[model samples]
Target: MEAAGEPIPLSALQHAVYCLRQAALIHLERLWAENVFTAEGAVLHAVADKGGGRHARGVRRVMSLPLASRRLNLAGVADVVEFPRVGGQETPFPIEYKRGKPKLHRADEVQLCAQGLCLEEMTGAPVPQGALFYAATKRRVVVPFDADLRALTEAAAADLARVLASGETPPPTPLKARCRACSLHDLCRPEAVARPARAWRDRMVAAEVGPR
Candidate 1:
């Protein structure tokens, strides 16, 4: 967890889970570039930002809802929040929009959980669950605000705080598929930077030890 009054963007947690260097580049270094994937995501967010509220049946739908959590020191916007009025009671839940499919990492889930945390703070109500709307799948993946996922989300926030406190970009951890998919690949240039640095560090170590 971050020290008091040191809030970071909730999106930074998603970036950190995807790649520490990527998170540092965006949040710490404040650099960004748009690629095909990012552009598509921007387009999706544009639609989400239409800022209209409506009700269907017993459910109230809100778009582009701002959220913040002082406990977690994170803030961001939800794509949609659904308040289902069931049996004269209402349960408010978040739904995030993603342009792509789910990945092996906890990036998307952490983001949604962070929103739930924010909602709980703002509404003073318990948020037991949320959903992720994947454009490719055209489905909602329900995510329970369980202890494990909450811990992961909090840990991600702390990880981001550490990165920001250091004020240094993290070294690139280049995996072929991950780097290839990352929109910031051109800016980060892991292959051009980190691999060569590793080689130089290896050479320095070898020189110091001498041949046995």
Candidate 2:
């Protein structure tokens, strides 16, 4: 729980899940760098970012919907939230735009679930599920806001709030695969920075073993 402060950004929840250090760098250090992948994502969100509402296929589609949850202390703009009639009542169905396909990790799902939580607070309606729309696949992967996912989202929010308030950037956890896709790769320099730290740890271990 944040106790008191600005609401944590919903996107920070994803960053926290993906890598806590990455979240700290962006939220604490205010660092950012764009790359091809991020540009593609921007293109995908161009229209939705404009922010408006419309009715399509009997569903009310709201773009760039601002969402906030006091319970989680999270706030951000949902790319698209469709209010489709469920049991004769309008229910929020958040649709997040992404550049890549479904990932093995649950970072994206956590973000979407946070949006559902915000919607539940704002609309006083149960947000049971949402969707992640991948630009590459051009498909929507439906996500249920089950107990596990909701728990993960809440946990991410708490972790993110803690990191942001700590006022210190977390150490780099270098992963070749994940860092390669990050827009802040150059700024992060995970490999360059983590190598020396890893080497130092190895040296300490060797020293402790005493030539074994």
Candidate 3:
């Protein structure tokens, strides 16, 4: 903790780590859009955010809990945390909610790992693993907080801090795939940018070829 009354730095780290343009839109522009995907995600989160404590067998489930780790510069709410006792000692297992099914990308893993790090810091317990529940798939994917993931999480936090401090909206590196599904497609105008770049490159090539 830096000091009392100090604002805890935002963990827009996940946004930056996932996509620079997305981070810029949210942090720099304060713009947001809720598409169908985001709406479904919000519904899932709303159910999880309802505070309640439940016990099943030997596992206790806690919901909508605020968690943070100053060491990791991470702050977020864990959707669900399972505390399982072994030999009369409580161990934490974090669970995060996702809007879609698992993909080839590791963005979701990064988010889950950050949450686990926060749980460890807040509770002073070893959190070796966590899980992400996908609303679309209706399944849970387990994530291990290994050394590599921890390093990535920490680096992401630092990168987010740099971006926020700079207060600059980063230019979008538009990909056809990203543009197709991006919620900010209209705002970003990635296709327009890509077409111009392609045209410029073609003109340069034509000039070099001498009217070819």
Please provide, for model 3 over 1-212, each residue's C-alpha lDDT reduced to its tens digit, 9 standing for 90 to 100: 12332323334655666677777787678788777876887888898889798997869999987888877555667888999986688889888888878866676787778888888888888999999898878899889899998898778776666666677676667766655666777877766766777788889999999873
- Candidate 2 C-alpha lDDT tens digits along 1-212: 23358899899888889888888878888888888887888898998999999999888999999999998888999999999998899999999999878998999999999999999999999999999999889999999999999998898888788777777687798877888888888898898888898899899999999896
Comparing 1 and 2 on TM-score, the stronger one:
2
Top model number, lDDT: 2
Give TM-scores for every candidate, taking all chains together and pairing residue i with residue i: 0.89, 0.90, 0.83
Q: Which consecutive 10 residues in model 1 have the weakest lDDT in total?
A: 1-10
lDDT of each: 0.86, 0.90, 0.76
Candidate 3's displacement at residue 22, Å, is: 0.5
Candidate 1 Cα errors over 4 Å, as ranges: 1-6, 86-88, 200-212
Clash pairs of candidate 1?
A: none
State which candidate has the highest TM-score. Answer: 2
**Model 1, range 1-212, lDDT digits (tens) per residue?**
23346778777788888888898888777788888888888888897799788997758999988888888778777889999865587778999999888778888999989999999899887899999988889888999999999998889888888778878787887899989998898889999898788998899999999987
Q: What is the C-alpha RMSD of each candidate to the true structure, in Å?
A: 2.8, 2.7, 4.8
Candidates in descending lDDT order: 2, 1, 3
